[model samples]
Target: MALSIRQKRVRRISGDPVDGVVVQGPVDGLATGTPLYSVAVQGTIDGRTTCRPRGWRFGTWNVGTLTGRSLEVVEELQRRMVDVAALQEVRWKGEGTRFVGAKGGRYKLWWKGDDGTGGVGVMVREELLEQ
Candidate 1:
């Protein structure tokens, strides 16, 4: 979605003593209390403002069982450039975080299950962990 705000309004809302702009307000078509921020760009045209495109790629899949194909899942997600993924029927016991895949394609898998029958999991790219 695109949001149009005046330069003066941007300055007023971003009252932080820091350098970047802190955009906090009701975004149209978005849920209430959604967080937003703005980063200063290096270059811009005389009469036009530049907007950097930023978004997350999410996906969902029913893997039946994650018993021994966790690495394969991670590799596939990486190949597709998926930032986050939700998995069903993980068939794993307990709940914890596991790091899978090799360097440059690493991912963190978080799973929760009562027995070894049905479970759910979420995998996130390792780089996104710091953010």
Candidate 2:
């Protein structure tokens, strides 16, 4: 099933209602280099609101021979309360999958990797899907 999402525009005190996808949970805790997209109207949502921090967490990992470094990212994210994460350059470091999987988040694993050079992985907590 496709989830619903909510989006608050830049500097807006309120969050605009979006259908089919809602942004919830802890976004503030997301790690650096997380791929956050500006919410776009998918099914015609009407609301006068702006984008603001919803306290959701995200992460991004630059993959390489950094098998030793993957854990570092997860550990750091844990410390920051990051609920979601994007791991870039994912290669031999199965640790990224394990880390996000262990978190038990409503995660999405994609292999946008380029021969272990410019790959990206994204992780999202299920709680954050609810607006």
- Top candidate, metric TM-score: 1
RMSD to native for every prediction? 9.5, 9.6
Candidate 1 pairs with clashing backbones: none
Best by lDDT: 1
Q: What's the number of clashes in each of the models?
A: 0, 33
Candidate 2 runs further than 4 Å off: 1-53, 59-68, 92-109, 126-131
Q: Kindly give the stretch of ten consecutive residues in candidate 2 with the minimal lDDT sum.
A: 4-13
Task: List, residue by residue over 26-102, the lDDT tens digit for candidate 2.
Answer: 23433343343333233333554433434554445554544456556555656666666666566642334432335
Report the alpha-carbon TM-score of model 2 versus the true structure. Answer: 0.41
- Give all candidates' CA lDDT scores: 0.67, 0.47
Angstrom error at residue 99, model 1: 0.3
